[model samples]
Target chain A: MVAINIDRFVKRYGALEVVHDISFDIEEGEFLVLVGPSGCGKSTILRMVAGLEEISGGELRMQGVRVNELSPKERQVAMVFQDYALYPHMSVEQNIGFSLELARVPKAEREAQVKRVADILQIGHLLERRPRELSGGQRQRVAIGRAMVRKPQLFLFDEPLSNLDAKLRAEMRGQIKRLHQTLKTTSMYVTHDQLEAMTLADRIICLFDGHIAQMGTPHDLFDRPANVFVAEFIGSPTMNIVPITASKAEGRTVLTLAGGGEVSLPDGTALPSLTNDGNVLAGIRPEHLSDTPTPGATARIEGVIDMLEPLGSDILVTMQVGGATLTARCTDKGQFQAGQNLTLHFDPARLHLFDSKTQMRLG
Target chain B: MRRLNPAAILMLVPTHLLLLVVIALPSIYVFWLSLNESTYGSDLTFVGLDNYVTVLTSSYFWRAALNTLIVVNAVVYIELLIAIGMAALFLGGVRYPKIMFAIVLMPYAISEVVGVLVWKIMLNSGSGVLARTIESLGFGMFNWSVSPPLALSVVTLISIWHHLPFTFLLIYAGMLAIPKSLYEAARIDGATPWQEFWRITLPLTIPAILISLIFRFVFAFRLFSEVWLLTAGGPARLTEVLAVYLYQSGFKYGEFGTASATGWLMVIGSLGVASIYLWAMHRRMLKGND
Candidate 1:
């Protein structure tokens, strides 16, 4: 079932339109993440869904009912804000039970509901404490507990873990994922952090400049990004993109790297029809590059090592290959030194090709 | 405890000297004066609490104290309600915020004495425009000068009008300091506008409200100008407040020792009123730190 179907959604601030005509559907029980850089209108789209922002043009439907004009409460959606947004003067119990109190639930019933949520979030012991008295992680849990007590149709999280320290962020991220697994409520999360998106989202909507860059599952986004932006954005250390010239030779596509290397497209590889000597972009993930040759490896590039950073499990080797600098993640077993000549190999099938002019991926 | 170094003591000397000259010496002098009976060019004979005993036993002193209590309470509470209302309206997104803010604060820009005088003239019984307007509407003369309750009510009104802007500014700043995201969270949590105010805005602004209350309580307890300039404790001295009574005792009757005792009592009373708010604020701060 489509929980939320946003058709041609548009948001405008007077004359300036921030969210263009974008469209998508969130399936029931699916966790959809809107990931992008700052000011990319990811939060705007989430706010529009939460009814905090007015939709300038287009239709928004929740559970097959039009909700463009509905108030946030009428929409029956709960939001966990980036800053937790707990009432500092109220105790944790009161904060969690505020919605119930507003709804005029009986005191015993409200207390039971609040207690249930507190138990679920493991914050029952801290119920008597105020938000100012709670630690950052505890406050975040209280916020989530507050949202949980509502039991709304949809859950909207606006960068909920962005304020937390790294370890707490990861811990809360796992807790949120576990909670989603147990509840299985449809959720939409907005974040600028790609790792959060990759880990938490069942389906990620990559946004760029108010447009949908791509919408797909995490594996699809990682294995086959739809554009140069998604290719560079979805992974750690980012994908290395170098300019290349493409030409057809012997019924196969031949790529001449701008630096000083060559790569031949494998047989039957889907290729964009290009003009003679047309410029193209070749994308390779740092993790995909190996210091030693591996199976299916067809491209070999040589360079002088420029820098090395160790990450306990692996080392990031930045090498100057002609005019282009490429970073490759190698295992820590290798005793690599800067200024040493090194050769790296990659599989041709793992390469991402884009039309340099449009920056859109080509099959 | 660590001893202060010579340089630190040297740096502190100027501040200590200033406090001694400005605060300590005057307080000590007032204490000394309260213990003596004196008139202009008269020998200072120590009375040993006789002035305090007389003031406490006098019906006039008790009447003035009761009047001061009623007037200060009315002014502080009424001003706070109006200030909260104004702050809420401004926070609800006013169109001409700057202009409206300036207008609300115009009373504060005027000198308190001038503001009280303006109110006094505007409400004068026989010829004032507002008084005539009220009388013409068949309210029968609107004579605040003759009736004690009416006179006290007018003083309270004038005090609220003059000092409301300060209270409003503090509460408005407190309201603004509440993060916008909290309101959004409340909205999503099924809070109506009224619920949002009760649960979020009012609760979060308690610190500001308490601070305003403490200041207004202290200032209103020293209420003098509005009463003195308008009624001058007239109509058989029925509208006399502590400050007016003290002024009459010192300047009008030439009883400086009694006036000094009254001054000390006023300080104690103001401090007593302010301590309630101070206690509440301290409790709130301790809870926040918990």
Candidate 2:
């Protein structure tokens, strides 16, 4: 295992910069997932690390040695591409053993290594099958087996599961995670799916618009999103944002709702520090908004039921509040018709405050 | 009435008629002529298997058949090697790929007769450019065009030159169809350039090679223009392919029956070669499938 370090990497195509001044380090044996939306340069960074793409500006080091000028073969890293990139002409056994054969390994040893990797990936029975004859999941396994047989210093997966169906994707994801644990090799994975990033990463590096929004453990991101984009991006169903006006009242700050209501803040509460106006915004998770009413410095909003999405074990309740639509998950299967009036109760501590102008989490 | 279905049989009538007129008519006429003892007129003596038997027994037919095979094999093999070599070189960071490809492909775009004419002027034994240059270099003017074996070899060379670019372009197109990621994967597997070409490029482009082989074989078997313009079946029929032999039998000797028989022989010979090529391809495909 080798520690991979990327120092201020920049990638430009002609005159347009796709990746701008991004830097991160991957510790040996760490599964670091670079998560971002499409065209945010996650794949570009992975390709640069694999030496498939030339780094326009930056230093890349493996185990403390600069390898900016090395070829992909010289870098000692294997990449499993998004499309699996399996050699269509070769059988699964040949595809897996290709790298070893190229390194001039003896035929018998190459076959053994291929069998070993195939067994590791649980694809040994498919060794005789060509890539086109195999299903998408089988092809992906062969692709991964091809990389595993090389036993390189690091492994790079560029959205390897994106092509698979939902059920097979879940199965393969678990398989990949287990393989990483057993191999104990450093790996870099790129994906736009936050769920995959959250599940597979030891630490998630969140990218937005060609810059790293935040880098932390999954819990760190779920608990303390450094900014608003990280908060909205890392969670499913998205964080709900609502505007509120703040004013100092009776020696305590009170937030006024637009629907002719107000909630008083607790004294000395560590909310987002506001400047200029009495205007601000609130971020709340859908799951945190409860149907049951609670007491004390909590805020409650009343609205009309607009829609309901029943997911097993939980029902997503959409409500019209403060001239905007907000979604909240309801655990109690209390029958409620559309257009019925309802109230949502939530803890103020669960409330995330952000500056109205900058859209950054303030406190 | 119900609306008409898009897959109705009526839609095929026009296309079937066109195929019959364009393709079936010529093939049927050729087959009819192959079985007859007839002049250019429609009057035919019903002779069953006579022309086929006579041509099959003739030494002239056998020699022309052997010569046609020789030319096709030589041209296709040499062209395949040269085309693949040039394609590999161009794809492997040869500077100015487009310019080099254009220069190499220039021969294919030129008129065959003009190319043969130019080469004849260059290789003329008496006062040709090559002869004059060799004399200037203190070597006596070499007897090139008048030599039977040399003329055949030179004609074959000219045929290879004319068609090499088409082969290169076909193989190059196939090479481009292979995604770049496969090469990257091979690189990560520690494959050198030559190993990548052998293990990845060559096997993947087998279909392209087969296509090029079929085209070159079919074209080379009837090799008429270059042989006609350059050697005219030359110096004791050394360069006489089946097409030239058929032409002389039909026009010079006024033996239309022999020429028609020779024409049918060339067609059957090409059919045999094509059948072998297709069978080999089919076997290769079946082995891969298994």
Candidate 3:
């Protein structure tokens, strides 16, 4: 079932339109994430769905009902804000039960509902404490508890974990994922952090300049990015994009690197034929490059290592190859050093190709 | 007890000296004067608590005290309601906010005596613009100079007009300090506009409200100019407030001892009213810390 159908939605502030005509649908139990850089109108779209922002044009439907004119409460949506907008004056119990109180639920029933949510969030012992008295992680749980108590049709989270320390953010991220698994409520989360998007979202929508850059499942986004932006944005350590010239040589596609190294495309692949010899972008994931060749490895590129960042299990080795700087995640822990000439091999089939001018993926 | 830092004590010397010269010395002199009987150059005769007894037992003093209590309460509470309303209006997004703010604060900018004199002229029974307008509208003349209630009402109105900007500024700042996200959260929680005000705005702005109430109560207790300039406790002193009674005892009848006693009474009365809010604010702060 379609939980939300955002059709040709437009948002304008007077004469300046921020969100252009955009359309998408959220499935009944899907966890969809809107990921983008700051000011990309990701939060605006989320706010429009929550009815905090007005939709200038186009229709918004929830559960097959048009909700463009409906109030946030009427739309049956609950939002966990970025700052955990808990009432500082109210105790945790009151904050969670505030919606019930406003709905005029009986006292005993409201208390029971609040208690149930508190226990689910594991914050029952902290119910009597005010928001100011709770720590950041505890406050976040209370905020989620507040939204969960509503049991609305949709859950909207606006960068809900951005304020926490790294350790707590991961912990809460896992908790949120677990909660979603148990509840299976349709959720839309907005964040500038791609890792959060990649981990928490069942499907991710990458937005750029108020337009949908790409929309696909996490695996599709990670393994087969639709464009150069999605290719660079969806992964940690970011995909290394090096400009190269592609031309046919000996009935095979030969990519000529800037530093005069040549790597040929793998045979028996369904890659589209190159009709012209022009500038193209070759994308390689940091993790895909290895100091030791793999079974499918058919291309080797040499570079002088310039920097090394140790990450306990693996090291990020940044090196200068011709005119481009590429960071490769090298797992041979102590084998690489700065200023040392090294050769990294990658599978030709793992290469992502994009038109240099359009920045669009080629096959 | 922690030992006081000599440097910190040294840094406070100037302020302490100023307070001693301006407030402590004068208060002590007043207390001393209240226990004595003196007239211009006459020798002082110690009459321990006699002046307090005289002022406390007098019917005129009691009437004046009652009048002061009524006027102060009416002025503070009515002005608070209007200030809160104006603060809400400003918060709801007013066009040309800076200009509107200036206009709201204009009353405070005008000198208190000048403001009172302007109200005095405007509220005159026969020739005043407002009086004629009201009479033409079939509300009859104000008769502020004759009727005791009318005189007191005029005083209250002028006092509120002159002092409203202070309370409004405080409450408005407090309301602005409340995070916008809280209201958005409340809205999503299905809160009506009234509920948002009650649950979010009112609770968040309570400290500011309490601070303003404390200031207004203390300031309004010393209400003299509005009543003195407008009616001068006229119609057989029926509109007399505590300050007027104190002024009459000292300047008009040359009873310095009784006047000093009345000054002490005014201090106690102001403190009595202000302490309630002070206590509430303290309790709130403690809870916040908790």
Candidate 4:
């Protein structure tokens, strides 16, 4: 069921359109993350949804009522910003109770609501203090508390975890996810961090250049990315992409790589008709390149090792393959040296292909 | 471990010297002169506190004091309202805001003497454009030059116009420095525009407002140019303010002792009023933060 539906929403600043006509429905009780690099219009779209920015075209609806013309107060949505814009003069209690105060809620009820949110955010002791006295993490919690106290129809978080230190970011990520689960509220979270999107989102929308590159479940996006951009953007080390041409060898598919090396596709594969001279990009995730291939292994590459990073459980090995630097996550603890030859294997099903010209995924 | 802290103390010596040569000496001379009956360049006869006592008991002094208080409150309150309104207007991303802001600051740029002169002609009963406009609009022939209340109101308006730019700029910068996200949050919190100003803009800009208030109050108490130029204590000494009273005592009557005593009283009165305002406001701000 749709909780909030954005129908072909467009945002323009003068003659320049920052967010193209983008459409999506946030499901009831679902946490959706909008993930992209800078200038991808993720934040712009979030702001438009929050009613902070005007929508140039199309309609925004909450619970089936068109809200494109409504002010933020009428839309019944809450937002937590990246910078934690807490009022400097107001105490923690006042910041949280501000919305209630604006709504003219009774004094007793407002106090109870403020205390409930403060306790939930574990900021009950700091109620009397102003924002200047709180640390970054505490300020962010107060920002979230301001949003939480309202229990509005929708929640929008725009990179709310980005301002904290790494350890604090991780901790707050867990807290946010737990809070969402407990409240079961529909949420739209925007961030440039793919890791946050992968960890917290029930669904992830990968945006690129003001367009929706792909949107799906995190597992689906990670395993079956729609294009080279998504394939490269969703993974930690990013997917390794190399130009390749396909031909037939021994009644099977053989992809000739950039450096004149060859990698064979899966055995006896039913294939699509292709032009022998057509160029395509072959994508392989770093973790997919294992020495002892997991399952569905059908391709191999012999390359000279460049560098290795021992990341505790898994060693991240760098090697030059087909004139492109490729990173592999390997568990092998054997002594390895640069300039040594190493053979890496990968799953054929995970070998993503995109048309070199259009950069869209291909069979 | 620091010797005489001469570096910091020496840094203050220049300001102290300027104050002494320009302020302290004249002030001490005035107090000494006020202790005796004297005119400029005449030998003074020591009369104890007679000059102060005489000035304090005078009905003219009380009337001038009352006029000063009226102007101070009127200008401070009226200019504050207009400044806040103008500041909010500038923040609305108005087209050509820089040009409009420059125009708004013209009052500050114009010399006080010239400013009051210009207003005097415009407000003149016979040929002033404002007077003609008001009379044409059915208000009848306006003659502020002969009425104390009308004269004082004209003086108040001119004062508000001349001093508005300072407070307007201060409040405008204060509004701009407030993070945009705070307003965004407020809007999401179901605040109407009025509530946003009352809850956020007004509260956050209180410090700037207070500073503007103190500045305008201190200067308004010294109202002289507009009152003197436009009305000159006309219609039976109705618009005579403190500075105008002091000027008349020193120059018109050549009573330097009484004038100096009146000057000292004016200083003390202004300081007392301004500090009370600052203390009350700052206390409220600190308590709100706590």
For every model shown, what is its TM-score relative to the native structure? 0.96, 0.92, 0.96, 0.90
Task: Sort the candidates on TM-score, descending order.
Answer: 3, 1, 2, 4
Candidate 1, residue A320: the lDDT equals 88
lDDT of 3 at A175: 100
lDDT of 3 by residue, B1-290 (tens): 99999999999999999999999999999999999987777887899999999999999899999999999999999999999999988988899999999999999999999999888788778988899889999997768788899889889989999999999999999999999999999999999988888888888888888999999999998899888888788788889999999998999889999999999999998998888888888888887831
How does model 2 score by TM-score? 0.92
True contacts kept of 3: 0.86
Tens-digit lDDT track for model 4 on A265-345? 668764444433656888889888887755654678878899988888788899987787889988867767788998888
* Segments of candidate 4 deviating more than 4 angstroms: A249-254, A261-278, A291-298, A308-313, A332-334, A337-341, B1-38, B43-50, B93-99, B281-290
Candidate 3 lDDT over A268-344, as tens digits, reads: 44455442466888899999888898886367788899999999989999988876888999885599889999888
Candidate 3 regions with alpha-carbon error over 4 angstroms: A248-254, A259-276, B1-8
Q: RMSD in Å for candidate 3, one decimal?
A: 2.0
Tens-digit lDDT track of model 1 for A1-363: 899999999999999999999999999999999999998999999999999999999999998889999999999999999999888777899999989988899999999999999999999999998887789999999999999999999999999999999999999999999999999999999999999999999999999999999999999999999999999999999999999887778887777778666665556666666533578888999999989888663677888999999999999999987688899999988679999999888887788888888888887
Clashing pairs in 4: none
- Chain A TM-score by candidate, in order: 0.96, 0.95, 0.97, 0.96
Stretches > 4 Å off in candidate 1: A248-254, A259-271, B1-9
Residue lDDT tens for model 2, A1-363: 449999999999999999999998999999999998998899999999999899999999999999999989899998899999898888899889888877789999989999889888888898988888889999999999988888889999999999999999999999999999999889999999999999999999999888998899999888778778888998878888777787877777777766645555556655666854857777888988888877765667778899988887888899887676789988847576789988888887888877778767777
